[model samples]
Target: MKKSSETAAADRRLSTVARHLITTTTNNEEEENGSFMISSSPTAAAGQSVFSNIVGAPEDPILGVTVAYNKDPSPVKLNLGVGAYRTEEGKPLVLNVVRKAENLLVNDRTRVKEYLPIVGLADFNKLSAKLILGEDSHAIRGNLVTTVQCLSGTGSLRVGAEFLARHYYQHTIYIPNPTWGNHTKIFNLAGLTVKTYRYYDPATRGLNFQGLQEDLGSAPSGAIVLLHACAHNPTGVDPTLEQWEQIRRLIRSKSLLPFFDSAYQGFASGSLDKDAQSVRMFVGDGGECFIAQSYAKNLGLYGERVGALSIVCRAADVASRVESQLKLVIRPMYSNPPIHGASIVATILKDRNLYHEWTLELKAMADRIITMRKQLFDALSARGTPGDWSHILKQIGMFTFTGLNTKQVAFMTKEYHIYMTSDGRISMAGLSSRTVPHLADAMHAAVTTVV
Candidate 1:
């Protein structure tokens, strides 16, 4: 009995030891499996260390150029990187008309600071639509046009893009190649694919009419084509009236929807009507279209963030339906646009005397840009800079595409402290009488040195 009891005790001890070994082996296997799982996953590796997998985004090309320009202490530094206009002394400008308009608004003492409708102020919308599409437009007359105030040009474009994405099934938007850089981002963010059509030809230093037409012709029917109403951005090249007509016909034939971005209107040609010719033509042809208008450039109200988006439809009922959908798109993006800028624009447009004065001021600004273009052209020509400088004068509005290669542009910046886009687009408004000669000298040196 004593021996049997001892054996049982031994058996129990052995069983206890086996159980311990099994647990130890299972824990070791678990540790190995966990390490293998972590090693297998890139995400798990990233989780293992905070700084291990971070990648920085590239700097914005234009903003980076501006930052470099700002850091320079050179007295003769010229910033033509941005499109904002500057005076003869190279200072930012605020129009006198804007001041008067502000005074008028203050004098009226309009109350009600409550949230505006998603469509924005009624008077602002009415005047904005009239300004873009003639007051006598059939769409307006038939009550087939709907306008909604938005957060300046970019915001307006985003809202319009969203509206198109939600209501219209045309999933692709065709923009000009070398378009304002933000256009692609805006449309794509709104769930639409952005494709490009040929626009500027660097070799000719001008518009590629044949390429543009071919691209338009080849685009799928019912696709959306974005057109710069006037003074094409970046390139400063515009299609002639004849070319615009042809484009209009092709768009109509292909059943492609037209979206006009009229940011520069009055600032383009100093005549609002002339700048709006393209949009008016499209509207007059009884084609459904969209117009995004900004008061930033024309009214010198950049900070005010005032703009409108208008949709032209086949009938008043359709216009209402389209506007309702636009409201839905805008509600989530921004509850409502600010009131100060819209009130200022409405005040100016309502008073005939103020309106006339504002027109003169706009014309003056436009004329100054035109004169700068001429001066730059003459300066380049006098210096005998290689290549055609005529495009300087030929191009209208605030920018002049100098056709300078990237190397020449870097040379200009490094040697002369002249800041411009790598694409060689120089804002003529930034060139004052005092700096024109200096810019000309730099261009001359760069060109000759390259030769």
Candidate 2:
């Protein structure tokens, strides 16, 4: 009986220690405003409830589509929400070249798992700058441009925004009215003011060039303007080359800063040079601009998160200082980028055969997305779906702004299990010939039956 009593006492002691640990951790987390916690007792659960007041946080509109799609058990369910590329069979793709690159990397006896520099792999940074700025770029040749490897396009953008917010003379940033949803959030969280410039025209289902020009013209001198280098997201409406030249003139004339977000690159038009023309124009004019370039779409390195940020300055000395400051901005956030992805990119880009193969594979992906666009448009036409579906073909890159209202999107989701963002933006890469008919039928039904 005494031994049993001692065992019970030990159990009580352990429970008491666990409870104390939980309380102490919870207290520390609360003091730091940490977003995560665990509870071990009823009292701890009560404390967790207070911390869980994050219930008020709104769902991410873009990611929420995937969440709802996953919960649906319907086999016919379609997810055209996020801008991820998929094969015609609706499966994610990892390019053959990427596989070969990985094979080379894994087999290399000389390679080590050393940490990259704070600015990232030097070879990756140099190649990335040349890829976006062109091999013959004068600024690059003059050593007036600084490039740093970053965590894909979003991370590059956030790092650039934070630096601009702290050092740039202007804090106000003007973005497209319906840009990628995260643009505003990224800039705002970086402590910059976000403003919208009119971009899409609902009437024509195209670029509101006049409205865009007016908005940028009215922006304060030296204000930062975000430009999608190619393949504008959500709407997929990009200004023509002539329009880009005009925009460049206006921005330069007004002394406004240009910040290019080149996420699509070769994935948009199947030619890296063609996609980079807009950015090159500003660089050619010997003007200062910021560029965030991503390989997620082009290299099929989505999860690998490889990208870079480049800043053009008037002199090499200024470029050096800009890069030093960028390191300061990145130090506390993420000390350095991952080595594997950067190594893969550098391996491909530095080699002639692998680089050629990469371009071919990139073109194939772009061609597939283009094919999906044509198939979707044809299906809609065959079904005699109401309204002009020409916009599907007119749009470029991985998305088509279907212009479907929120109610129609809801109806399609409810009745057809075809999931897309409420804003009617659909990832064209997500569609296949097999699924086009289902989407077409849903559109036809929604348009005809819904008021």
Candidate 3:
């Protein structure tokens, strides 16, 4: 009896301690790293959840928009928060060219699911490099670029960040103030310091060019700069070619390293070459830079995760050495990339007929997005929604920063069942002719009623 009483007392003490620990972990975001916490209680350890320390981590601000949208039962609910493209009927798109490429891959009898090298598919790498750098690129001609297929844009960025953290001379990276939210965490966890430079000017709903110049000018020499090759996210504002030239000169003059993220390569103005102008300008100068390209947006290969990382070097020998190091970085992480997506991209890119078909399809998608932007603008204007809505037409790419405050966003969500990130960025790709009026109505109500 005495021993039984002692055991109960000890169990009570442990329960109290466990409660305290759970509270601490919850309050501190302990599971942000996907922490696996063991339970302190014998009962929990023996038969129940061992992960007692787990706090329900917050959903991703960017990705969570979809999560919330999925729960809404409203028939009229529109999810402008999703980043993927949607048809006019509000369905996820699978490009016709992508289907044709997949058919080619599936029918090829010689192809196998063998593991690719750490540098990924050789054909995919060569084609991806050519696609971004152009056919007659100086870097391509001189073999000064080392291209590696990665697990789409995020994977490529992470791999590149890891490589830069390990090999690059400077560890500090300057990203735009309002970049893809993932950028900061990707670099920070890679053991690099991430600082922000002003990019979006909310007051004018456009790029703060003067602020951008000041910020980049102030960065230390050899610091890494993350540039959205085209179709800058969130705000959808891109620098003019002349502005890009100026920015390029400043970056080169300061000897800053350029790392370009080319996610929406063909979406900005419906032409791949036009969208690639920024990255090409930097490469045209025969200087060193890094580029991460994603097929998620352009080729609609979201699930396949097709992308590549290209490191442009001053010389072929430097590029060769960089490839060796990149291989080292990749081998330990994911070992090698999957072969299926790479094959599809390669098949489409290398063939002339399919390539031509892809460009036309890409242009059509871009034209539709451009049309949606105009429709949204006209809808707002037709209602006399009292704001300068011209930015809607001006901001290029899949998104538009609506400049809606959090309260306004919440009001729209609560009353109208419209969903988007709290920061007012909406995926124009998600909007279509059927849903424009509803969105415009929500925007009008939110702007006039909430604020």
**Predicted structure 2: lDDT:** 0.88
Write one digit per residue (lDDT tens) for candidate 1, span 1-451.
4444324434543453343334333232222211111211235553476544543333356667788998999988889898888888888888887898788777776566888888899999999999899879999999999999999998889898877766675768899988876787677656666788999998888999999999999999999999999999988899999999999999999999999998999888899899999999999998899999999989989899999999999999999988887887788778888999999999888888988998898898899999998888888888888878888888878888888878889999999999998878898888888899999999998888863
How many clashing residue pairs, candidate 2? 0
Clashing pairs in 1: none
Compared to the true structure, candidate 2 yields what TM-score?
0.89
Top TM-score hit: 3
Cα lDDT for residue 291, candidate 3: 99
Count of clashing pairs, candidate 3: 0
Q: Write the per-residue lDDT of candidate 2 for residues 1-451, one digit (tens) a residue.
A: 4444224434543443444345434342222221223443344464466544332333467888899999999999999998899998999999989999999999999999888889999999999999999999999999999999999999999889878876776878999988888887677656567788999999999999999999999999999999999999989999999999999999999999999999999877999899999999999999999999998988889999999999999999999999998998888888999999999999999999999999999999999899988898888889888899899999989899999998999999999999998889999899998898999999999889875
TM-score-better candidate, 1 vs 3: 3
* Residue-level error in angstroms, candidate 2, position 403: 0.7
> How much is the lDDT of residue 396 in candidate 2?
84
> Which pairs of residues clash in candidate 3, taking residues 3 or more apart in a chain or in different chains?
none
RMSD of 3: 8.9
lDDT of 3: 0.88
For each candidate, what TM-score against the reference? 0.88, 0.89, 0.91
Quantify all predictions' global Cα lDDT against the true fold: 0.84, 0.88, 0.88
